[model samples]
Target: MPHTLFIADLHLSAGRPDITAAFLRFMAEEAPKADALYVLGDLFEFSIGDDEQSPLNRRVASAFRDCGVPVFFIHGNRDFMVGRRFAREAGLTLLPEHQVIDLYGEPTLIMHGDTLCTDDAGYQRYRRITRLGWLQWLFLRLPLKKRLGIADGIRGKSAEAKQDKSITIMDVNQGEVARQMRKAGVRRLIHGHTHRPAIHRFDLHGQPVQRIVLGDWYTQGSVLVVTPETETLQGLSLGENR
Candidate 1:
């Protein structure tokens, strides 16, 4: 059956070789068989800049290049620095934060899901600052070593901050989700970010809408497969290794 696959928050890095291996296996075994593959966001743990593609990034790009099916990427908060250079090298198309597309006869909206967490005011402010073109350009101009050091520092702080944040704040705001879906005129929405994978059904003025959250690859692998007839979330067990 022709179907599409959605994945997010793999957070692939040299530190997580097992997860990386699993992803490569996925590209080889699962992705190519699908009609199209949508990588919602955070494919890497951190991407300093496209100009700083490390050996691991090169390998990942090569893997995508070999995946036969069309691949699309949405920039997650963690890897928003991925630019045209990386996209070209990886053989993938980069989509905007919120995109609506026809999915098996239904209009579906896709996103990285960070913007929907509007309750996190501080994080939202940080996002805006970091995403400014001028700021990103300035950051990219720094020496590679400096850029990496800054990224590591920021990541550490973000991890610490998450430990203190309420779960509700970290997750998407229901109102925001509803607003976005309505704006896009889509009954189905797919995104990855919060790492809380679940299917949420909403009733909007006599219409039914579904929101699908993709899981993070921190401990196990998760993917959402959608065909015309069915949509399901499947997990890859890490077992004793995790």
Candidate 2:
């Protein structure tokens, strides 16, 4: 059956060779079989800039290009600093932060899913400030080493912040989800950020709706396979499903 694939939050880094190997395996073994692949967000642990394409980035780009599948990406919080140079190299198109698309006859909304966490005001504030064009312009002008240092510092602080927050506060707010669905006019929404993998079904304005959350690749791979006939959420084991 013809189908599309959705994945996100791989958080791939040179330090995490296991996840990188799993992703490469996936690109070689699974992604090529799909009609199209949508990478919703956070493909990298941190991206200082597209110009600073480390060996890992080059390898990932080669993998994506060699996979021979139409690939699309949405900016995640961690990779928002990434630019089009790598996208071109990877043979992938960059979509808007949130997009509505025709999903096998149904309208589906896709996003990186960070903005839905209305409760995390601090993170939301950080996102807003970091996404500013002028700020990014200045940041990108710095030396690559400086940029890397800044990125590392920010990543460390973010990890510290996460440890202080409760899980529920970090997750998506139901009201925000509903609002986004209504605004997008979609009955189905797919996103990945919080690393909670589940298909949530609920009533929206007396109609059935689904919010699909994709998991992170911290331990194993997560895939959301969708065809005209069915939607399946499966875990692609990295020899460590436990």
Q: What is the lDDT of candidate 2?
A: 0.93
lDDT of each: 0.92, 0.93
lDDT of 2 by residue, 151-207 (tens): 899989999999999999999999999999999998999999999999999999999
- Per-residue lDDT tens digits for candidate 1, residues 10-99, read 999988888888888889889999999999999999999998868889989999999999999999999999999999998999999999
Best by lDDT: 2
TM-score of candidate 1 relative to the true fold: 0.97
Clashing pairs in 2: none
What is the alpha-carbon RMSD of candidate 2 to the true structure? 1.8
lDDT for predicted candidate 1 compared with the true structure? 0.92
Candidate 1 Cα errors over 4 Å, as ranges: 238-242
